[model samples]
Target: MNLLHSALRLASAESPPPNLNGVVSTPDGIVLLGLRGKPLPAAFDMTQDGDWILPSSATTAPTARNSYPAVASIGRLEDGSTVFTDLEADSVLHLVGNRYRAAELLRNIALELGTSVWAEDLELIVVGLDPDLTPLGHHKVETFDDLRPALQRFTDGLDLSVSELDTGQDGAPARRAAGDPSDALVVTVLVVHGVDLYDERLLKDVCERLLARGRTSAVVLTSSTATSLPGPRLSVDEDGILADVEWAGGHVRAEQMPQDLAVSLLDVLATAQAPDEPVPPAAEEHPWAQQMTIDGAWDPELDEPEPAAEPLPSPARTTEQERRLVRVENDDPDLDDDLAEWGDTETPARPLIAVLGEPQVRAPGGPPPIRAAWQIEVVVYLAFHERGVSREKLTTDLWPDNKATSASNVRRTVAELRPWIGKHPTRPDIEFIPSLSTSGDGRYRITGHLLDWELFRRLRKRAQARAAAGHIADARADYLNALRLVRGPILSPLRNRGYAWLNNPDQHHDTLIPGFVIDTAHELVDLSLAEDDIEKARWAAEVGRLVDPDSTHDSPFLDLMRISHAEGDTGAMRQYAELLLAERDFEVGEDLPPESFEVFNRLFPNGLGRAVDDR
Candidate 1:
């Protein structure tokens, strides 16, 4: 069941299944490490000739793979027998050899043990290693800067486990029978890159104490200099091969994890353990429903006649009004010249499909003929994939479960969509040219119509280019212009209904579009704040929130908190802080992201004080 659960999680994270190729049957308590060279006499009783003898146990099923948490593979003999180590039974395993080789071998052991199916209750405390293992994101895997504190914590935990066992409620044997082996004395493995960092006496004392208990706890030490300690010592050569062991006649390749593969595996593990999908906000709670426009304009409905005396504008209101006026008046021709090279040739006579917000085909002639949801989807898909999608790929993605009818369905949908997309201005024969070739296997692509998303991307690119060239003011304008093109979230109309392909992590529209929106808004907010334009800053933050209502990125909420603090609005500051905290709750074991917590602490040194105090 554990193996099955891990496989399912890997699938969800879009990662390859675990490689179980070398896995073979092993004894119950012996634990299968990598293979060792078998004696010629031992090979006589084996199924195959050269690499046969594996420590077999009657209790273990013939087909069962290595029981992880209890087993670890160190290296393989030249004849292909895997060398096994019983981590649960072994109290201390000292790795001595070239510092770099030993460290690499230790890292591989940690990776294998950490990513095992039964590693949920396994705690790995690593010291003096700079490997970027954080991407694994497992709550149990931790890195410590100093050995003293980590050792102290380990001893404390050991004492607690020992005390729990003494209670006699349920001993380790009983817990193992119930299939919850970790209930008593969680499997904690301490991996130290350099054993010489601590006093040799203290290290030996700790290991001896752990060995005395005979629990599923152990310490793995790696060192460059030769040192004698209790338990087995495996010397690693500069080439990462095991030496001074009777297990082989030499030429054993150690199991080493490449940097890239480790990172990829860690990413897979992180994704598999990601927090539950956050619920979408209700329609009323959505940014669009809060009287806030995507471009940061507030369009409140008038409830009564205007007052005879004009009300004094708050700092936010004054800046917002001025910003609006600046946008309307085309007073600067130089800004136009900076963007002239990238500007569109001319506006389309027909309304282009709008996908930046709601998925819609705006045909100026009359109501669009595109009535089916699939028709709009087809057009939107082509608009995003300008390179064109093959018919098979499109059908496969769109109708994954109903492959038999998908080809016909896609053909009919495209046919219905092409007419509404309209013909190219100069080419009457190309009626939107939904397909590039007359051949049946030709690719499907939409042309002759512009996409709002494309325009948004163009403006954003220009803004970044301008900013890189040190044209701050022009860059700000470009960012604002790009933001104004966004009506709401990308494909807001298809929130829960369709477009399952967008959920893929590789899709640019799913990942990159939101990043672009958040970045643009964040930059705008910073620029506004730099100029002391409080209202503009507030507006920029709201625009960011409008696109990312879930507050996935911390910058938007952080911007708002700063804006509220600058305006001396404690009430608003507290609200933004709470929202920021909720959004950052995805972090495992941590209260908040570092930057968010820092801002929160700065705003409310006495903790998010009572809301009534602000009043």
Candidate 2:
């Protein structure tokens, strides 16, 4: 590997440590490195993550001051893992498996934390993984963590404590009490190490919970030898954008990454805890028990799940996690384009619905009658409307514990939908996007030719516009039609588990579509309030605030109070204002509409309402 080789070649330390992958020494001089492929190192310390920073001068410039090359020669290992080859064989040396492992250990131990996945496994196996986490290479790690006892002997009186594993009474609590300099937050972060995109379920849970609470999130891949990462770190911050996670790398030329970039990618391994579900400290630490179905514990919690028992060649457009987006784990730049293609589910495919257009298609009990199975068709239509959902979610909703084969059932359902597809004025309303290979890269596409939901949206917009123009009848009709899409709570075939978190909710969904649903509700509330429909307005406002508490200033309840003022119902206005003020969660802001502010002032002369208390 050019990068690692260069890093080592430049090392100018007096009698510098060898450029082996797993070598370590404390501030004092003691060496540890793995010999051959042995599980344990010949001599070393046992810090879960070892620290290895090259001599500062050696790190930036190679021993041999060679200029950049258009095509850098990098070494590739068979196990899909790679290391940089430095031209400065003198100043820098390639550091791959063992070195990487040593770094992993030192950094973590410095942070006073344990490696979640390899806590007990001092022997590490470093494999090259593509951005999508596909194994491109592998290599056994020979590191200092394997020689905890020997290193302790060497230090004698050094200020340190290293161990073989972290799970048992590792004495962290004792260390902390003794002023080891750590807090509960640091400990919590330590617990979530060894997790990442590979843990799809955990990722979903974390993102959803965060969104529900209106808390901003960042998914930056960081680097640090200490518990905390440093440098010109890029954070996603409060804005919901994909750029934060994308900065690490689309595809890593594992063999050629600069030492800094390599360290950055390591951060993606996800040792820092981003809650699977934000369990309040007051609640059980782990609300959900582990259901271990896989072996080999490198964070099995985040390990890629096995394909469904029956891996069926799904109909065009159906994919699992079609929206996870494709990522490249290699150094290949072309990977981004290929990934983009997988995500653009929009296409010309017609709805997966059955058609009523076929002549003689309508038959009696002797034939596959027209409406014998309209349920599947409706479900598929809803799926299409949702921009596509995952099979796990769909199955969970449809057959919670039923063992019936899912493929056969889905196929049978698709067959049933073929007859009535064209019934909707917009035939393109439904479609099944194709999936990309066994890797499960994909996206759901809504066809441009479809006018179903868009028509409803347009009607809703027009209704709002006309209502402002005092065209009540027309506006009401459009509003009713737009709400028709809600015929049954966003519609998921998933039956019993609960789907409220879905495009349609019942329980199938793990959580609600916090952002989207909240926005929709608020919009509807604004319309209802403008139309003087106080009851509908208040209901919409409450739902909106529940979805996102920050929307308090614009909640429908507040708007209705203002309408009451214009209608001159001072009593009703006070009653509605009091109701809004009683909402336990909403923190009303000073930015309330001027009209609403006036009405609120009238209702609560003291600028505070205490007629009732919220739970």
Candidate 3:
């Protein structure tokens, strides 16, 4: 017992005792069949009268997402901000705040699980944990009021930890007239059984996500987790029978067993769990710190100061929040003289994304014409951050009010964008310019990143180091090649007009193809809608309403009209929540956030939630 008495006996052990009487029950309030209530489900209780409003239902009911919320707060929403004043429910958030909180909780749980069980499969849910855990403390993370019965009691009942049996056979995997090949060394043995044995730092965080491909091959093993229970759960017949692995664990450990073989060996020794994968763990905290705890609610104290956020009419694809640095051929000449005294180059940092295709609006009339408001806003904000963006958040997102006439229309759109940028023989002394800063002093400064935003920061750091080594199908083929080059839109919207990108400003670089096609249709609807896929949740709500026709009345096309009203039609789910509150005015807009419409009010329950219950 050395290392300082094993670090003072692992700091007097922690966690396990605070189960708060382990309540855990579930299900309540509204969401009858769509399911959601578990923890944070008590927000909306509206009802007006004249102008007939009426929102009342969500007091706490939610039970359908892979089930279990009773207190499930995953948190992370940035796409332009505003989930309770621009996000901040910190549990964790890494790779670009886990791709902006996994594209807003996988598009609100793939439209409240249209294909059920949080569908979207391009994988990458990740979550190993224990980097000295402490966002709230004692493993604290239970804030769900309603989210499908606390995600059906934490994905069918949070076992927490239990798996220890591998009696050592050398090697064993191929078991069939088919996959039958063996060496028999299957050791899992984990037992953090609700964490205790001197609180082994989250069971050594399951050996930091197991994977060993090869290195003096004992198949190169490690992560052993367990306290007991790598058996049981039978019921198999149709020829691939084992009568329950011969009455549950008594013979032929390997041989013709692909079917239930004791529920495929209880899903092969269950105990690798590590779900809530956000992971930022506060690298100086950023994901919006719970939207800065209502930081004066943007402007209520001064009796109203929050009115600014509207820009992007193409002073070259404007809108840049923070993470827009994009550095490549680093010489550090004071960061290349702060990127040429501030033209912000290095091409949006290069990873190789590709989602493009926008440019067909303003047609049905005659007026929308007068352009060149400084050469298409610096040639569409450096071709919408070299074709992929969701950050670097430009001032009021591209010039809201008048950051000095949007920095004099971005220094006169970078003097006709130094003659249309074209060459860069892989960073030939760098060039893809555009960037200025100023979210501080007296405020109002625009411009940022360009090196094709480092192809989504090098395919999200090589698909998160190939999913931390396990390489789940090569991190789902690099998240579908970083979501097909993310088509194009990170600043283009056919003219929000500007002092800085004031919303549309006659869209150049074609609103970066609907902001990289609705951010890769919300990251391919965050992977086939969490893996369920009601036809890819109606083709990711039809490419997020064909590149934003106001998201066909938003909330992912009212979650495809609540999955076509649960496959039937309670009058088309009350006419898709009374057509998103009569022709799309359904609460929360100054850019977006009424909790980003938590799955469109759990599935469209219109009526200005009585003005979000008057706050």
Candidate 4:
């Protein structure tokens, strides 16, 4: 059932399966029908005379053959290969068996076809069978109480032109020629129960017409009584064994579905068919721009400079002679020189702890001799809360369920981690993690050390400042440095396992770190594009994509699309457009945003529909 759900989810986003004589092919071009017998089938020799290659031998049991037209497993061969049959094969398939067994086979086929990715364009017209398929919620399924109305409905839906239709040898109208069309052709499979009750002439006419139209197929549930329907007869016994399968050679046990499983499969397909909630419009603009700024307010002046104001005399200048002397003497060191000297001596060594990609502890010595996983988690937690966290808060967050020993657990963890973190580099007397009692306020926090996360933030802040000051090159440099520190998503090494506190909406590193990354990447992209450095722009966009591949914030994709457009790579532009469109379709069940559509339309004036048609 999980496999069925996965297949449905994947199939819903993709185009219909390529039509290979009514056989549904997976994305990998193989048809996975289901399991067969209890042992592996011997591999077929390549030197054999046959054009088709057989599956390789395996010592394992229940082998599934990936050959064509074999859409579902009916039974197992003596050699362990599955007996597959395409329920929607090109010709009409008449299932002759015990009434209940035949109906069960029909239900199984319906369920498989309904959930199959390859059958996206398949329309099932079920007549006279009440397997309770309404709960399936698939748009293609239509159940009728009688055969006459089902055939009438199927006939009325046909939209063939005069040139498209031709009289077959049996005088039934069929498709004249199979031409490659702009859209995928629909394959209608007419499933009928109790064929003897229907008018024989009506059944024969519909089957002939269906066979003439090469893309269509039919399956009829018939009693043991001879029926006028023309096709190979597959007999199912009361014991559920299928006999006289020409392709399968001998009889094999037929697959039947329990009513409960059919219902469950239908429910899952219904859920898969349900439309996804619309993605909110928040991602249309740069969501991170406001958050990445120094004052938490993005400045428009940073992007567009205002008019120069009237010049005013500097108050620091004494007179023209003093100003000239000051300029000539060059005795006073500028702010850049002073900051350079200070940076050379004051900038701390590489952060001892990193929470950017993996939660890592690079102690003064090679690797920290930390004993437990909790010790690393406690350090990362404290590092994230740079201001400091109280003993009560830390315990409650880290061990919410284990309250009685939470306080002691924190105490023990910090005590064990203290030695490994070593003494503060600048202040040797002060340990990296200060004892709770050492501080007047009983809050524990890391001191005299920086985390990679903190370093990234500092660099981003510097980049923001540089950009605001119109130092484009310097700002670009700072942004690149910040982005380099981001090896992956925040705390990716810990994943979702130990970071309970991270889920707190009030202090969410998940959103905060990615926001900074996206905003910085966008800044670099804009700077690079302004300088016509397409390679750098591409690098920045790719990095932004790495952080949020799902396009939770779609500005990164939009930036990439814009870059692709600039490069005049229409194919790449369309690829990005389709990705953005697919994301929107999955998340919001809607079209691309207007600006995004504009970019796509600019490249392909006829629209995405025409672009697809051209393909």
TM-score for each model = 0.46, 0.28, 0.22, 0.45
For residues 71-114, what per-residue lDDT tens digits would candidate 1 score against the true structure?
A: 56677666555554556554567777876677677778888767
Q: Could you tell me the C-alpha RMSD of candidate 3 in Å? A: 25.3
Tell me, by lDDT, which candidate is best.
1
Worst 10 residues of 3 by lDDT: 1-10
- State the weakest 10-residue window (summed lDDT) of model 4: 1-10
Candidates by TM-score, descending order: 1, 4, 2, 3
Taken over the whole model, the C-alpha lDDT of each candidate is 0.56, 0.31, 0.29, 0.54
Q: Put down candidate 2 lDDT per residue, 583-603, tens digits, no spaces.
A: 533223122334554545444
Tens digits of per-residue lDDT, candidate 4, 1-615, equal 111110111111222222223212333223332212212223221212111223321112211212222154455444434444544444466667676776677667666666554455456777766556776554778888877887786665543411233332311111211222311134556677667644567878766765665333333333333466765566777777775542224556666776677777667656756787632221112222222333222333333324326432444645543333232223222323322332343333423676767676655534445444667777778776766888888877787676537567678877877767777666777777789888668898876554566455555655655566566898788678777777787677573457788877645776667766787798889989888888999999888877774577676777887787777676787677677776765311123444554545444443332232231
Backbone clashes in model 1, listed as residue pairs: 33-83, 33-84, 34-82, 34-83, 34-84, 35-81, 35-82, 35-83
Q: Which candidate would rank higher by lDDT, 2 or 4? A: 4
The global Cα lDDT (0 to 1) of model 4 is: 0.54
Q: Residue 329, candidate 2: how far off, in angstroms?
A: 45
The alpha-carbon deviation from the true structure for residue 127 of candidate 4, after best TM-score superposition, in angstroms, is 35
Off by over 4 Å in 4: 1-351, 403-406, 586-590, 594-606, 609-615
